[model samples]
Target: MMIKAIQLLVAVFGVLNLNGIECRKSRILNSFEYTAINCRVHSASIVDFGGVGDGKTDNTKAFQKAVNHLRQYASDGGAQLFVPAGKWLTGSFNLTSHFTLYLQRDALLLASQDVKTWPVVSPLPSYGHGRDAAGGRYISLIFGTNLTDVVITGANGTIDGQGVLWWQQFHKKKLKYTRPYLIEIMHSDKIQISNLTFVNSPSWNVHPVYSSNIIIQGITILAPVTSPNTDGINPDSCTNTRIEDTYIVSGDDCIAVKSGWDEYGIRYGMPTKHLIIRKLTCTSPYSAAIALGSEMSGGIQDVRAQDITAIHTESGVRIKTAIGRGGYVKNVYVKGMNLHTMKWVFWITGNYGSHADTHYDPKALPEIEGINFRDVVAENVTMAGRMQGISGDTFTGICISNVTIGMAKKGKKYPWGCEDVKGISSGVVPRPCNLLVDQGEGIVGMCDIPADSSAIDAMELKKCSYIG
Candidate 1:
């Protein structure tokens, strides 16, 4: 269902109720304002803390001091820090609880190029090691941990991460730690990051890990197409999150839904479940529009995505896993997608071939089931589908319906490459492989979106604003 102005807040998640009407519904999620954090009692500008926005001054201490001064009002109706219209050069700064950081229209937050500006933090317990190295990693530019009710919003302001040097260091293997992300919040709840432009990120644009009840909306992220690991949005081991009305052009996957790496993830047992993504526009020639994981050992379930648009992307959706990843991906539904200049329309692989360490158990097989895709249209496709599953542990319970794919002039002769996978397709163009046999009308209600009512159905966003 599409409304003229509505911002969804999912505290609990399962699936959307749009079945056959998924594609026909209107898309109008960008017309409204949704606030996860209410107005604060105290508000102060960065200049009040002796902050100079001269684009060369080190504003790290000023930012930290501003946050420290307003933190006392957390219980006294919270506080907000305002960044005026200027260039503020700063390093990594920790956010406080019950706080909001707002940037004016022309304001810019520039990440320092000095390595010392970034503090090193230990690797996530689930990841076991830094993604790019063996030891601790650099903290994000805007970081917070174990906090609640935080908002980082702006009036289309920009956050620029000077990442060319980091990219060069990574390519030369000179980095001893993982690159920093633009923004990251860990073990937090009721978080909102909206209405901002992020560019040239060293790594992921926004990363929410071990968090819940999060909302990310109306954001634009851009990076060089060849920049390594500059993912748009990554939600790791999170729950009940909603990402909507976002545009991204990146080197990596636009949205990478992850849990953790191999054995560490299984031991942590914190799955990323019950998430919703809608109204997304992505462009990444080398990566999928939305990827389900090469690091999902902690398991993933109840993910629903719809109203997606991709251009010059690798694939519309891809599920990646290996034998050592002993997690399960189930109850996933995607619908209402429009793709252009894609490689393969759909892809799933069990031979992802990347692991956290050598200590992983080879016998640990990931379970993939109950995946459904429908109401999609794609043009300029190279191949239709590349469905490869584990030899013995075949992926099952997949359903595709009401889809149309137009092949390019040099498209593959064999549009569908099937392996150890089985599914059913109805009303699909170019016909699927023998594994996914045509079901015609028999596929009715077989790929229905999972539906159940929880506290998320009852939750509604309240209107909030600031006068100062």
Candidate 2:
């Protein structure tokens, strides 16, 4: 059956190519690209299963029944769950493998605000405790585990998590478990989430953990600037992930790439690798636009980000780690970024002290190398870069070139601050700190952009449409 699906996809690709539609060979086409490929067309509407979309009815049971009825079609060439144009009020619901969840343009998936509706699950093995608490955690609104070929795409619908109560509880220290994410897929693969709008998540908006072969594109995620832990999208301990053409306004990092916490991560030993982030526009007054980690005890490598715009953000690109994080972050590259009104255009710290537990060894030092940034322009920057490394294990092989930053009128006394790190800078504004030696004019060769890489252009998806 899978072979048949592949053959159908190939035939449709041939047709599309013949019609002057260019498709790159570097990345696999998403479900929208192969809409003409016919497999088993087993589908059901949520409203047919007694789901009320009046914005007040509890559709949790309706959703469960619909999914349960559709699970049988997993082996019958997959199934699609269609959500019509209305407000769907539901609690947590599980997804099946080989399934597609499609929402119409006027549809809204409204999360139940009642705390009892959320289920409490055990902490991730890689992290012994919840990130915000000491025990279990609340499952996400749309939760799935160990599923394959799962897709959540639509005609730019909305998933609204009324998270004000959760935020209040967190601030008052009345929460027992960690707050839930908006959408979380764990231990799954071949996943695609696009053309959606996410708002007011309790914690992270979209989290894909311990998964691979994922694509997230053309989505908008928004949260209040003061909300706690409402990161836009966090790709945790995943491989072969691509995030592109997304806009984010969040209280935390727009795109935070994390693995596990200190000692737990070192033991899990699963690194997040081969990531591509491009064409992203972000705004966060108190957080970085793109943060590699404060939770990256597992190694992170081979990351490339380009063509990004950051406005009114705290920091542009941040790499955060501590002595207890016993992993290496290497081969990171960033280029073609535009920034405005930033506290610091770039920041890397070695003294971040957030920990899940006390079991992490204080002596386990982290390693950072091969960090490169080029072709960046910024304005109203207070400080250009503040890079701090541990005393013994200095961050090495850092390179910055072809970057121009205009400081604010009341900017910091020093534009750059560096300690315990060794690197070279060329054609950089404010003449980076003395720690970075002035390499000669021919230093452009130090920055390398990956050719033939799976960037946004390589994964351009067809605009999807839905009929209500």
Candidate 3:
């Protein structure tokens, strides 16, 4: 029964290497059943498709074959591909619709360092040029496009990028293409990426762009404190996404909400809205726990974050934008943030100054308003707030209430830095700027944690299992 598999791939796809999943990459005869969003009419192990997880051999073909073969069951009840315990080494693999990629608890999928394993793809329409280079960029280790009802979940399985090589190339200006992320899903819907440990990603770790109905939960992302551009969980141009119960330690922002960049973003014209973030813990010495744009020109709105915890981060929540970026960031609500050792508790600025190219219109201006924060506490803070807006166009409709921040021993003399922005503050420490002092406690009513329901709340996990 284990012999005859898929129609076309069964013949040429070749050998089963359960051996690689044991003895550090050797196959072992192991089988198990697990639960997920959908049960599979058919399932197979990577070993059945020449998988050598010995930590040395390249299992790229094996992974590709397994996914491609099982994809045929999509029209029936869907399919699942199980990856057992071992050190699996591979490069890039694409997922199909109605599929699940499950890794065992001890399984470690190591990314290949060989450039040939990675295929360079064209830049995103929202960003005309590559992020780090002038042209194309490497595809992610696990990529999927135009897919639906996909799940990339495991029982604390690990996906290690081994990104030192990529990082060095980026720092030395030796690469012609931008780096690849660990997992990227584009133009898809009903995606769930959870219960995974992602480390040392080449770039952003779980990027969902132009997608919707995504649930990213129970994730642990870790990278070196100095690794460049290793952002965790960047949701770009997506809607109705919920990111919860995630822990991250990184060099960049733990969670970055973006839409697009510059004129390309303006042209793409997709705003990320109706996002719900909850129970997130982050530690990043050089960046914010949560950031919205330095690249949001497509617009961003209807964001909600609550029960956030940050330790030794640059800021608790940061909004970054620049000129020539004609977007809007509005209807943002944040509450219940417990922060420690932060450069600033809240930060919003429009002088980020990174443009896609010189041709971006200088007359373009972003609309930033309706930002609210309440029920936040912080200790060991260098400063409380840094709110800067465009010189001529001041940011308005801001409110803050029920917040307390204790400054660091040798922190900045002035706890608040404000310019070209108007807001109302109540129950804030260190006495905010005169422009924000006019409001009373009524600001709390406006900025409190909203009781509203969103589309993402309707997404529910089901009892789905695969057998082997």
Which sequence of candidate numbers ranks them by lDDT, best first? 3, 1, 2
Each model's lDDT: 0.86, 0.84, 0.87
Q: Which parts of model 2 have CA positions greater than 4 angstroms off?
A: 1-40, 452-468
TM-score of each: 0.91, 0.90, 0.93
Off by over 4 Å in 3: 1-35, 442-444
Q: Over the stretch 176-198, how does candidate 3's per-residue lDDT look in tens digits?
A: 99999999999999999989999
Q: What lDDT score goes with residue 47 in model 2? A: 56
TM-score of 3: 0.93
Model 1 Cα shift for residue 325 (angstroms)? 0.8
**Candidate 1 lDDT by residue in tens digits, 302-374:** 9889899999999999999989999989888998999999999899989998788899989999999988999
RMSD of each: 11.1, 8.7, 4.8
